[model samples]
Target chain A: MILNGVEIRDSFAEAFPMVGTRLIITADTAKWAMIAAKTVTGFATSVIGCGCEGGVEREIPESETPDGRPGVSVLFFTMDLKGLQTVVPNRIGQCVLTSPTSACYAGMEGGAKVSIGKALRYFGDGWQIAKNVDGRRIWRVPVMEGEFVCDHDTGSVSGVGGGNILILGASRAETLAAAEVAVEAMQKVEGCILPFPGGIVRSGSKVGSRYKGMFASSNNAYCPTLRAQTETKLTPEVASVQEIVIDGVSFEAVSACTRAGIEALVALGRDKGVVAIDAGNYGGNLGPFHFKLREIMA
Target chain B: MSGFVLTPRRAFETRVDLAGVLPGVDLSGLTVGYGDRGVALAELFEIGGSVGDRLTLKSGSALLDRVGAGLSSGELVVEGDVGDHLGQSAAGGSITVSGSAGAYAAAELSGGRIEIAGDVGERLGAARDGSRRGMSGGVVVVGGSAGPRAAERLRGGVIVVKGDAAEGAATDLIAGTLAVGGALKGKAGRGMKRGTLLLRSADGLAPGFGDALEHDLVMLRVLARRSPDLAAFLGGAFKVRRFAGDLNAGGKGEALVVPAA
Candidate 1:
């Protein structure tokens, strides 16, 4: 089916389960809060290499924060609960604890929990103080500028990761523009984060590589340069493609984010360099969750 | 008014013990001490209303002792002044006294909440002779000042006093937190081993304390946000001058006093 000259593929995006946690980082100003959020989420675009996938969920206003300071909400996803428990503290301890005038807290509530402060409290040596406030244990470790207070543990959620939507267009510039528009729209959805560089992946991967010991490699099938030699999914007119991957607190959140991007692109239609909308799937075999393109657009 | 209301038949000749007699039941078979003689509860106060979650005392006297002691569940309300050992050794549930409480109020309390609208006498929330802890868990909110030796040997829980505390507040605190919104009179924290005494005035601190720099404490802000009712005692402080002390008693305690206006 097509909408305004763009094809709506029958394909679906395959996603799998993940353990995720959300942390709220606050600072005297919004700039530092965002900085800490970016730092902790840095190098965390994929679990295969980075061991986690994390991104800024949103910015919190002063009135809502624990200290009445400006804050940023960030989400991190790992392949398992144990992995999440490891990566979150390392990031917060190194990045946030060192950030001046900043404090971290458990942003999400309920479900299972992982201790972020238990691993970092040793930084205080024998000076750290542990107390309970509103039933959640908090650890306060004195720092040079002041004190670094954080929840002893934050709640972890069973989430969905690897949800994707591919923006295929006739030229490189148009394809990038289309992906940009989709990213802008998808960011509005709650409980989801785009964990890629600029929320778009240029070198999208298939399942595995021909080289020994490599688990994943580039998607040659969707590459414009390999259109002639490989089993290319791209049409002769299609010149470039961009992948927008999503990781969220729930399957429904990923689906909503995907639908938001599709809605935004479909509204812009052919005028924004006409092409088609497709999704990534491993023949619907690997992951348990599937987001069908046509069904979603319908 | 809906729950059990026990009003005295007349002024007590001697202090009476009213422990373990809870609500949600009839007091017909329940026998309690009236002075040295055992008397039926009906022989004392005029019983009114059916059994319910709350047990309200229409009036109180210095003769009423061990009020709501060993209360495991349900609410107990006292409308007037009560004698010593008010809510003593209660494990759970909530006890609220609308009037002043005598000495040993909530002494050896392990769990549950106690709220007093007026002054509490000396040795408030203090442990008895042999026990290692007093007011071990739960919260106590005193709307008015406290007498000397408040929170003695307190191993756990929180106590917030809205007005000045007399001498010896937190004298032998073991652990947990006690925050006083008003000035602390005379020397305090004499034998504090491990705990925090958050107060507004530091003028009365003992020589056992040594000045630690005025520093920002995020825990105060966090506590203020978590429990707003106790925020007044924390002085809504972003920074406080810490006195690391009771050094004569092993030094793990602190008296965090908010800067003077």
Candidate 2:
């Protein structure tokens, strides 16, 4: 299927089931909230190396937050439930609690409930006071700037990760620009995230590895230098490839984001050497819902 | 009986547990469903009340725990006395008791108003067991004296006791206001962080509180006008002796002792 002269790859984007949590981190201002959120979501591009994948979901106004502060909602995902429990509190305590004038709250209401504040209350050193308002428990810890209120527990649920599309461009600059636009467009869609560094990944990986110690290795199929040596599928004009990975709360959310990112990239076509939009799939055997690039674009 | 009236059919001496009776149970149309000795609400109180403007529970000594727990809207009036927790977490409504009430009346109340014409037992407006915060919002007015530990660890809300308050009143209050018309001999405003506690008595002040300043705060007028029973203590205007601390407790709360000049 050709969408706006860009060839839609017939392959589907493979994904895996993972447990996820949404957190609302608030600060005195929107800028600080973004800083905390970005820090918490940093190094969390994939469960392969970082053990979690997280991204800024949205920005919330002060009136919308529980503590009346400007906040940002972030989605964090892990390969399993136990992995989620390990990654969430560590990141929140290190990134959010250490931030100035910041408070953390649970975005998900009732799911696989785990207590973050109940565990982190030890940081207050006998000064943390628990407040239960309207049945929701919040812990107020004495901080240098008066108090910091955080929800006792947050909810976690199963989500999908590794829903991705690759932009193959003739030059590195063209590939980076198209990837940036795709990231911006995908970020606007709710419940989905581009978890890579600056929402673009140049070193996309495959399922298996050549070394005995490694479980997975890089995707050599899209490597520009190996185009002539290997069973290359890239066209003659394609020189560089940039990948965008998405983690979403559901299959529909990921599909919607994929469609949006592809549409945005296609709109800014081939000025520098943009050739086609292709997807990475594990032979349609990994995930439950197979999102074919051609079918999704059509 | 303009509104709903709940009248017990027969007098009950033994405690008839009513903990889960009024949970999401509407009291629009007032009437007794069923009643007997040592029986629960299902056996005694008939469910016939329609959603209305007000609900009146005709007085008796039979009711036990949780009479009106989690009531969201409308009005509830007890013609006589009530059991414990008369209006626990009542979101939006007014509950008036003509006689005394048992322990934990209006515990953890969020919004609305509760007025008891008679005395109240211990732990009125205190937090439930194992819960941290207590009575985040609402206004509670007690006409007679109140028992010990009244408004303990209250986060936010207003509580006014017209008669003398028992020991440990307004202990560990985080926010909101508490006004007592009669004398308070016990440790008042102990470990308060940020709140206003007004004592309209000549019995002097608690040792835990230190004198802050002497001024006539006009906010008392606004608070008094909200409840007529509380308004009587203002008496047009009076000198408010302000005291700060529970210095023992970070020295944040202000205790105003109103002296008659």
Candidate 3:
């Protein structure tokens, strides 16, 4: 589909099933809340190496939070519920609990739960107090800085990961600028997150590798440096490619984010050094969820 | 919430115990006590109204005790004053009193919610005579002052008194939170083992309680958010003076008294 002078490739982005959960990390101020959000979401770009993928979904107002403090809502995704149960408590204990004047709560109310405060309450060393608020149980651990209050557990939801769209252009700078704006637009969709740094990934990977130990390697077909030697998916005019990977609590959320990102990049058109839009897939064999670029934009 | 309506036929000649009479069940076949004799409920008041999820006492009386005792489900609404042991051992459902309630309002309460619009008599949410656990699960909100030994032997749950509390408030609190809005008189939290007492004014506390430094406890904010009934006591940032004790029992319990506005 060609519109606004940009080509929308017919290819689809493949996504795998995952277990996700949302958490509200609140602090004394908005800055600290954002800091806590950033800390827990760091080093979490892909589940391949980091064991999870996470990003800040949005900033929550004081009136909406459990403790009436400024908060940042974050979405974390792991390959399975067991992995999510293990990784969530560790991240919350090491990041949110250590932050100054910070408290954590469950952002979503549905589905099964994983222990957050229930896992870290022992840090109080017999000083911890548990209170049931409304219907959910919460723990108050007396810390040096007053106390660290957190929900007993957070709900775990079914999610989709590795939903991506690749933006190819003539130059690295324009492609990057387009990718940046696309990320900014896609993040506006709730229940989803762009797990990569700045919501943009330059090294999009394909399954399998030449090295026996490595599970994944770079997408050589989309690489400009190897275009002459490898079977290229790009034309001669295509120079740089940047990918936006989305992880969301559902298929509809990932599709909405994909549509939003493509619309932002398409708004710039080819005159803005944009060449085309494409996606990565493994012949529809690896993951169950599929988002066709043209069908989504259509 | 339209359910059975029970109105008094005449002034009670003697005290009446109307416990465990909830709207969720068949009231026509039920029997209750009048003075020293057992009588059918229909003889005391007209049992007229649809059987649903609400039980409304058209007018509560001072002689009517245990109005909603052991209510397991449904809503019980009282339009006037009630006698002692108001919601004893209520495991579920909600009881709302539009007028004052007598002593032992919520003794041995394990679950559910109780909201009183006026004053409550002594030993509110306290342990029963033979039991050590008081108000183990659930919430009791009193819009007016409480009598002596309020929240005594509280093991869990929450109790918020919006008005002044007489002597010995939270006297033997074991756990949970109790926020008293007005002045607290005499030996509060004296034998507390683990619990939080948010009081506005506290004087003549026992020597077992030691004054701890002031702190902006997160529990205050948590209670403020979860229980809106305590908004009058916590409308702004609540920087409180912490008194840790009763050391004779265990030093874990804390009484956070907010400096008077």
Candidate 4:
């Protein structure tokens, strides 16, 4: 399939199962809320090394939040339920508890719960107070700034990770620009995150490597430097390749985000140094969720 | 599902215990103990309706005590004034009392909701005999005034009094929230241990409370969000003067007094 003369590959983007949780961090002002949110979502770009993948889902107005303050919603994804349990509390305690005038609450409910405030109440020593609000327990830990309130626990749901879009451009600059616009488009879609630096990955990899100790290595087929030496998938005209990786709470979110990224590139036009739009797959062995490019665009 | 339309047979000489008569009584299965004798409920009241999770009682001259005591689940509607121990030990379900309720209303309740359209007597949502923790779970919304010792020994849950509260309100509170819309009698929050008492009058705060500071607490916002009845009472004023108190009890509890507009 082609849109504005850009090739839309017929293959699908593969995604694996994960456990996800959503949390809301509210503060006296938008600045402090963002500070706490960025701190908690920091260093969490990939399950490959960071142990979790997360990003700011959206900014909530004071009228919409539970605490009548500016808030930001964040979504975190881990490869296993146990990982979610360990990461949620550790990140919240280290980031939110330390931020001034910040309070955390569960963004969603009804699933496996991980301790967010139930575990952090220890910081209060013996003065931590627990109150039941609309059937949900919330803990208020006394702090220098009066108090830091948080929900007892947060619920987790099944998620999908590793949904990607491969952008091949005629030059390095062109490839990076296209990937940048694609990432921006994906960020607009809720429940999904492009978990890479600047939301773009240049060193896209395949499962396993020649080195016995390494689990994954670079995709030689898409590399411009090795185009002639290796079994190249790119034509001679293609000079650079970049990928936009996405992790989402559901299959529909992943598909919607993929469609948005592809539409953005199509809108950018092929004359802008674009070559092709494709996806990475491991022979459909790694993940259960599959999003075919043509079908998603259709 | 049809519910029971219960009407008292005759004005009795003494009070009647109407506890545990919810969620599962039929036309023939209904029974109540009056003083010394076991009276068949069908013989006393006109019990007619499809049996379901609803129970409606129409009272007469006789006072009905413990109307919804120990109610675990279902819906209950009381038509007239009820005696003491209303909804005592209630775990789940909703109870709506159209008229006034006697002392110890909702005492020792663990879960569910109790809404009273009229005034409530003393010890509202307080602990019963032998139990240290009282009203551990659930919400109690009183449309009118509340008597003394409201929310005494409360372990958890929310209690909102739309009108004035008598003396000793929130006394001996063990964590919970008591928001009074009108004037609070003296000595409120005495011996409190980790609890919040919101008073609209801002008077009657004891000397034990120190460190009085004015600020908008996030918990108040949450309370206003969860209970519309409270939000209406709080109006637009979000600022509150917080007095950390009951110093004799370690000084952890707080009394948030809303200033006059």
Candidate 5:
């Protein structure tokens, strides 16, 4: 099936179950909030490398924030509950606590709660104080600027990760541009994140590797360099490819954002050098939900 | 008007321990249904007025200890002075005392409103002597002066004292607002963070609060409107001296002293 003259790949995007927590970090101004958020989400591109995947979910207005300050909501994902417990406090302590005039709170209130502030309160030594207002517990830790008011615990829930799409183009620059556009679109969608660097993955992986110890290898089927020697599926016009990976609280959220992103990038295919938009999958066997590219685009 | 009212049948010389009587008792379920001593509530207090949405105790001086402990909802009004632990762990509801009350007036109250028109003993809105969490949430308004440690380890909630407050008011307060209209004799907001302690006079600002700033805050205007009792001290147009420290605890909290006009 073709969407806007670009072929819709029949293959589905695979995803895995994970745990996620949302943190609302606020500061004196939006700049500091963004700075702290960026740091907290830094190096958190994938669980394979960073043990977590996190990104800025949205910019919250002061009225919606806990402390009536400009803040940003961030979504952090980990492969397991224990990983989440470790990654949340460490990142918040190192990044948010170190930022000036910043306060961190749990965006999710109900469900199973994890104590990020309860653990980080040690940074305040014996000076930490607990405050409970309107049924919400917050910790007041003394910082250089004043006090950092953070929620004692943050709530965590099961989420989905590893949803991905590959953008094929005639040139490396064209593929990168298409991927950037897709990332920009996905960033606007709620409850979903493109955790890769600049939201683009250059080295797409396959199920297994030929190396004795490696669990996965590169996706040689779509490699422009190996097209002459391997069983290549890429058209002769396709010279470069980039992938966009999404992590979301639910399969529907990830699929919806992925669809929007793929459609937006596919619309750019009418231009020169743009080839097609496809998704990466492990033969529809690894994940629970199979998001068919044609069905999603249609 | 909607609560439980216990009017004593006869004046007794012996002090009656009313502790553990009001636990899990809501306004509708409370009744002086008549029994002997330690039997039903009717035997202790005369069954006169109809049980409404609130429980009102009239002309009782023999009552002592845990008068309104662990009350979840509704109102409990005591016409006479009550003993210790007036409204302990009162999750939700209002408990008003026309007369004075003993120590731990509203200790560890999670939610609700407690008002004492008369004076209260020490530890007015504090934790249960040794607990970490004090009045977690709710509002406790004292028309008269409060004893020492008015809001110790208070996690969240507002404690407003219309009259002068004693020493060690708001010590180790984690978060919440404490407003004192009269002069504070002792340390205020010691080791406090992420909470606001507003005092009418400069006496309440401890040595920990460093710099002072003079400015008009719009939020103060809103706060005054919500609490008219606070309006007497924070009312009209006034310049506020802001102290930023408790620097010992990272100095994050603010102590706003209403400058004399």
Candidate 6:
């Protein structure tokens, strides 16, 4: 299928099951809230080495936030519950707890609850006080800035990860620009995160590596430099390819991200050098959620 | 008047308890014991409404005590002034009184919401008789003034007094929130262990209380959203000057005074 004169591959984006939790971080101002949110989600681009994938889901207005302060909602995802439990508390305690004029609240409700404040309250060193308000337990930990109020626990739900879109462009700069637009659009999709660096991954991977110790390696088929040496997936006209990986709280969120990313690129038109939009999948062997690129872009 | 309307037929000198009668049932055969006399509800009250969970009492008698005592559920609306022990030991559902509620209103309330649109007598939302804790759960909102010792020994839940409160509010409060939208008389939060007393006006901090700096508390925003009546009183105040007091006690309790901005 073709959308806006750009080719839409029939392949689907394969996504694996993940565990995720959302956190609402509020501060006296939107800037500080974003600082805290960015800090909490920092270094969390991919699970390959970062242990988790996280990003700022959206900005929350003061009226909607628990503390009546400007806030940001962040989503953190890991491979398992154990990994999620370990990463969430550590990230929130170190990042949000340390931020100025910041408070943390659970963004999602009703799931497998993992303690955030219940565990971080010990940082107050016996001075932390637990307050039960409106049936929600909150911990007021005295910090140098004043007090950091954190909700007792945050819930983790089953999530979808590794939903991807492949952008094949004629030039490196054009492909990078198109990926930037795609990421910008995907960022607006709710309950999802583009977990690659700058939301663009240059070195897309296959299932296994040439070496024995590695589980994944570079996708040589999409490499322009090795197009002559191997049976390449790219055409002679395609010079650069980049992939945008997404992780979200649900399959709908992943699909939303994919659709938005493709639409944004399509809106840029063919003259922008984005020739084709495809998706990544391990031949239906990876996951149950299959987001078809043609259907999404169509 | 169209629903269940219970009007007093005679001046009941005896303390009448309307605890068991519920709406949506045939009340013609219903009877409640008043003092030492087993009074048939049909003789005392002109029951007129159809079957439902809502029971409205018109021309409420001040002599009617324990109007909804030990009420576990259902809605009981009183049109006129009611005597003491209204909604005592109330566990669930709601009770709205258009007129004044007497002493011990919603005392020992474990669950549910009680809204008194008019003044309430002494010890509103306070501990029940011979009990250590008051209002272990639930919410109480008084549109008018509240008597002295409001929320005394309150262990949990929230109590919002939209109007002025008499002296000794929040005295010995164990936990929970008590907010006074209007003037609070002297000695509020006296000997309190823990809890928050949000006041709109602060004549002066009662003795033994230390002045704390004006700080921004996000939890208040959460509270504001939860209780619209209390939010109306707050007028959207996210920052408040705190006065931690009852030093004679644990000094954990706080009186958050919102300065007019």
Question: Clash pairs of candidate 3?
Answer: none
Q: Report the C-alpha lDDT of model 6 over B131-217, residue by residue, as the tens digit.
A: 899988788999999998999999988888988989888888999888888898888888888888888766634686788879877
**In candidate 4, which residue pairs get closer than 3 Å at backbone N, Cα or C atoms, i.e. clash?**
none
**CA lDDT, every model vs. true structure:** 0.86, 0.77, 0.89, 0.86, 0.78, 0.86
Regions of candidate 4 where Cα sits further than 4 Å from its true position: A207-217, B59-62
Alpha-carbon runs more than 4 Å astray in model 5: A110-115, A125-129, A132-137, A143-149, A266-274, B1-69, B75-89, B95-104, B107-110, B115-123, B126-137, B143-158, B166-178, B185-261
Q: Which one wins by lDDT: 1 or 6? A: 1
Question: What shift in Å separates residue B241 of candidate 4 from its native position after superposition?
Answer: 1.6
Best by TM-score: 3
Better-scoring candidate (TM-score), 3 or 6: 3
How close is every model to the real structure, measured as TM-score?
Answer: 0.94, 0.70, 0.95, 0.91, 0.74, 0.94
Question: Which has the greatest DockQ?
Answer: 3
Writing each residue's lDDT as its tens digit, candidate 2 over B37-139 gives 3444434444345546666667545254566677776677778888777788777677778888898888898888888899998878888788887787878
Docking class of 4: medium
lDDT of 5 by residue, A1-298 (tens): 7666666777888888999989989887999999999999999987877889999988999777765579899999998999998889999989999998788888886667777778988988877756544555567676666567688898988999989888888799878888888888888888887877887889988877888877668899989999888998798888998998899988889989988887787778647455787888887777886777878876
* Candidate 5 C-alpha lDDT tens digits along B1-261: 543567777765455656544523533333332223444556667654454556778874524557778778767778878877878988887788888888888898888888888888888889885689788778888889998888888777888888888888888877677888787987877887657788877676567878666755534443454455555557564458777667787776777887534
Model 4 CA lDDT for position A270: 83
lDDT of model 6 at residue A281?
91
Give one digit per residue, the lDDT tens place, for model 1 in A72-151: 99999999998988888899999999998889998888878877788889999877877764456788887887779888
Q: How accurate is candidate 5 locally (lDDT)?
A: 0.78
In model 3, the Cα lDDT at residue A267 comes to: 90
Error of 6 at A260 (Å): 1.8
Interface RMSD of each: 1.8, 10.4, 1.7, 1.8, 6.9, 1.7
TM-score of chain B of each: 0.93, 0.84, 0.95, 0.93, 0.84, 0.92
The TM-scores, chain A only, for the candidates as listed are 0.98, 0.96, 0.99, 0.96, 0.96, 0.97
Per-residue alpha-carbon lDDT of candidate 1 for residues B1-261, written as tens digits (9 for 90 to 100)? 357778777877887888766766666668888778888888888887778878988878878888988887889988888888988898888999889998999898888889999999998888976877888877889999999989989877788888888998888788878888788887888888878888777877777998887887767777778776557565556688888879898777889987533
- Each model's DockQ? 0.56, 0.10, 0.60, 0.54, 0.17, 0.55
